[model samples]
Target chain A: MYGGGGGHYDGGGGAANANSLFGGGGFMPSQSTAAPESSGGGSLSKVGPERADAAAAHREADHGRGAASDDKSNFAINSVEVSTIRLVGRMLGKVERVTDVAFILDDGTGKIDVNRWENESSDTKEMADVNDGNYVIVNGGLKGFQGKRHVVAYSVRRVTNFNDITHHFLHCIYVHLELTKSNSRLPSQINASTGIPGHANQVRLPNNQATTFSASGNTAGNDVSSLVMSVFHDPAIIDREDGITVAYIIDRLKLPEEVIKEVMQKHIDDGNIYNTIDDLHYRSAMNG
Target chain B: MDTSSPAAIVNGEILNKFVGRRVRTVVQVQRNEGGMVFGQSTDGHQLTIKSAMDIPVSHFMEVYGIAEHNQTIRAEVCTDFGPNFDAKAFDGLCKLANDKFKHLFL
Candidate 1:
């Protein structure tokens, strides 16, 4: 879940995703277009239970740590009551060759060598099981293997749970660092929502490509060029008509008239519109 | 745990631009919800601006208050919303953001 440094206008505000929010801080999706639905294509619902569960686990399993403590998909362990943890990542290499039935699955955290010795069903490891690019959630029990951490799972699920709700309810920005593809297996993981790279995914990144996510912004406007985003805000509340009001503290000059008009529509209501990536720059080039 | 004066790190514009005093840490601010404030300070507690009247919202700060509980300086509000920066620790966080807590900055 990483890599998405957005663009800036003429007076940038110091906003970490912590403070500065997109679309004026609304929490729903915008649905007010006369045009066809697929025109600007985006999701409209909140992330579902399983994906949300994985997201929490993903936050815990951030930046490559040990497997026992790496609660990637089974996050509610601390807050919620449950067993059978969930995990997500790529199947690195055949543990003992492609059909040997045992291998390491890198869940952005550390490699979790998985093995199903007793019940190796021929159809179990489908295209979804070994497919490297997509995200998946696996449920299983932990066991030690050759000093490396391992999980003996009875089941696995893919992250293809996309639906009509997904296209409009945007929550984050995840960037797929272009360079990760060079290696036979991209070691690092990229957040499809926020371009901010995590250590779980950082372990496999080639050195030079490591810093390309959040802070690496020589890229003009810091645009989310190839990043993935969800359109989750309700447009009825955001008043984009007044345009995106960016407070320019440098020269006290607000967002330029053109930049705001370019991205937002007019007469936006007030409670939705938090899925923007337009960057804000300083009026005076003090730091630049 | 000395309640005498809060050990603070000043990163605000008020201390830098206005006060030549250079508040390395603010021991405390006298909050009244009344009367235009006249400053009170000794050696380490001294501030440049006698009052918060002149500072802008972004320019000024009243970020911390002595934690009556354990004396550990914490955030004014606990929230799962907007950047949850514990204002007191702002100085300890490097400009480059290199720690778990510092990720809140990024």
Candidate 2:
């Protein structure tokens, strides 16, 4: 009953044959999507069982590392759990051995040894291109051996984009801030305050709740940018033709003069505000 | 290789914070004279780098060394970042790393 006019056993043929049966459509539907309605159900069903077995094998392999709860000492920086770390740095030195290869990497913040272990399926030929002074991106797990910590590298590739060097450092800083500052709101505090019955054990608190906590916790420190703009956007001052003066903002916010000036300049440059009477006086773009 | 003391990245503006400590910064070389390089830092401050090797003028050089003073670096290693490097972005990175996220590095 198949459209291509072949025996039922001929369904074992792959996409090309399936395409013909589907009236020569240019786009190829994936096996999983095609399997349910297609006439080649038998062959596709066989592939399904094989895929299931492979997935099972993959799950078994991942079981060890996936047990994050059991392993309390899993690699962490600033008390944030990090399973894999990606670092960009200059390769200071390299040592090759039969079982593994080790290289010292210096990324300005610190220097650490990154080791890539040899496997029967993979060859160390790719590492031949890496040399001293070459900047490389190392992705791996952090491990300690005999009291010395080193990165057990999964892959080491030479950096082609010059921007990656700067990007890596910025990324490190971003992740550090995300972990330490943003995620510092304890789950216990959320439980104590909110009393959300089901969310007592949940680590990921609601975004609004986190915002509320941070807003209430450190008003003067964290929200300086927003606080600066609030003066310009204030209902009382928003309609002023000459705009709000920097002195008024400083007096209202009670922040340092330098910070007020810097934030004002940034907002002006960003087109969020513009000069109304002079550079000293500014009006929010939102006012118009 | 004394890798234990990893250099903290600094721009001209924040060099004073890392005095007597290992630091790294990118500077655009303005002139070179007698083993000393005078350059403009990413943050547009004048920096004096003490180097034994000849440094290329008008090129961006990443200097890794001890911060001798507010605007001086005792250069241990210098890598030429080429003349076309982005100074403004690097300056922003330095500021963010030092100011908002100082705890991450220090």
Q: What is the TM-score of chain A alone in each candidate?
A: 0.27, 0.40
The two-chain DockQ for each candidate, comma-separated, is 0.01, 0.14
Q: What is the TM-score of each candidate against the true structure?
A: 0.23, 0.53
Docking class of 1: incorrect
> Candidate 2 DockQ category?
incorrect
Q: Candidates' lDDT values, in order?
A: 0.26, 0.52
TM-score, model 1 to reference = 0.23
| Residue B42 displacement (Å), model 1 | 48
Say which candidate scores most in DockQ.
2
| Model 2 lDDT per residue over A1-288, tens place | 011111111112122222111111111000011111212222111000010001000000011121122222142222223334455668877988888888887766556677888663333755665788887666455454553445676556666545546654554443333333434555555334432233334433332232222223333323665466445545567678998888988888788999988866654433345566665787754331
Give stretches of model 2 more than 4 Å off: A1-73, A77-79, A120-123, A181-288, B1-4, B52-55
lDDT of 1 by residue, A242-277 (tens): 223333211122335554433232111111222233
Worst 10 residues of 2 chain A by lDDT: A51-60
User: Model 1, stretches more than 4 Å misplaced?
Assistant: A1-83, A95-100, A117-129, A161-288, B1-106
